[model samples]
Target: MSVGLVVVSHSAKIAEGIVELAGQMAPGVRIRAAGGTDDGGLGTSFDLVMSAVVDADDGDGVVVMCDLGSAILTAETALDFLDDELRARVRIADAPIVEGAVAAAVAAEVGGALAEVVDAAEASAAASAMTSDQNSPEEAVESTSSDRRGSDLSSTTLPPSSERPEEPIGANATLINPSGLHARPAAEFVRLASTFDARITVNGVDAKSLLRIMGMGLGIGSSVRVEATGTQAQEAVDALTTLLASGFGE
Candidate 1:
């Protein structure tokens, strides 16, 4: 069966770089990312990660990779909850999320089978050895075997609406968490809101960045009220409500 690949990393840029380089090595595969945020958020949720995996796989089987150990465990836990059909299609790569993700994605994105592509990726990353300032790939690889809080600022930021609506709804959201809106919750919230066209502005000290949202620092069981108008208003609210009610499926 055709297989897809998922890459998880503390930094989306690192994850992307791996995929880009891997494409050079393996031009016949597919890959997708699940971690942090392009808009800039830290900490990715299992549901969101699963969503990314599902998106990349596109049927057949999929290989999953992660940067930090917690992310890997989170990925594993997420896999456990996936629908049996999708769960059957996914397998974790015994490799670095950064290097392995790119390698596997390059293979699968081009139409390679999941296992073969992952095996090939393992070989390639082993040979190439993704490196940081350190000459060894292990330095660049990061460790998925254990959890480490890297420099990812997992917080959300929302800039003042530059484009004012002709019809505006003065919507206000609260940070109900004991801590307030940090890391995991922010990532989950962003993932949920992305599904609908709701213009979600995470309100907090630095509420303009996706990373800020992830690291916003909301306390326990806090409520962050999000307001949006337009076609996606109601649907966005409902979807977010469901996600929040389930603890963002954490």
Candidate 2:
């Protein structure tokens, strides 16, 4: 089931950062945010909250975490917005915001229950220096060690899986170079692309991305289109021509 996480925060910046962090923590999980930047504003309203909740998980169930009193109250108020059926599946969890997002990501990625993720988030916050100071020295030390261990695990963010719908192709990009696409040509193509505001994506039958591009084992005579969009999209044609002019890496 496709699960969506709705992160509600007082500040859009905080909500944005949490969503970005969640994307890193869990590659495929869908996370949505609803918030206001000003102080004293109650969290997401009933309509927005229900929309985010419904948008994220559909019928798969969503974990909603909010900040502060009115925000919490606001979430409670929003529940009435859900129909009896969706309401039954919705859960408004109370926890420290950022920690909740992280735990949610981990839980979503590891297939753990949402309840466990909420528990982790609350626990993490309670022991956080910004919050309660409830841990004993030994427990603190162990938690510190575990935290360090988590750091050692590669924190590199994976690129999102293809989310864009396919557009109809106007031309067949065939790899016609005798030498095929290699490091220099790939670099040249990427460098050419850096000049434009256009969004460029390279996908082969094998896959998309530079890593996958190289891994596709395009030995020579590869014809790949330098597709582009935006004001400088035409530049993609020029840039690609410059790179492909040499007939790819000879």
Instruction: Give per-residue CA lDDT, model 2, range 61-93, as digits (tens).
Output: 677878777777767777777788877766776
Name every residue pair that clashes in candidate 2: 174-223, 175-221, 175-222, 175-223, 176-221, 177-221, 179-220, 180-220, 180-221
Give the best candidate by TM-score. 2
Q: Candidate 2, after superposition: displacement of residue 247 in Å?
A: 34
- List model 1 lDDT by residue over 1-250, tens digit each: 3576677776767667765654443444466667675455676666667787778766788787777887888889888888898888788777755445544544454455667666855654543432222334565456532234433325535345775463422244444444344444553455455555546554422222233354344576555655556677767766655555555433
Q: lDDT for every model? A: 0.58, 0.60
The TM-score measured for candidate 1 stands at 0.44
**TM-scores of all models?**
0.44, 0.48
The candidate scoring highest on lDDT is 2
lDDT value, residue 222 of candidate 1: 59
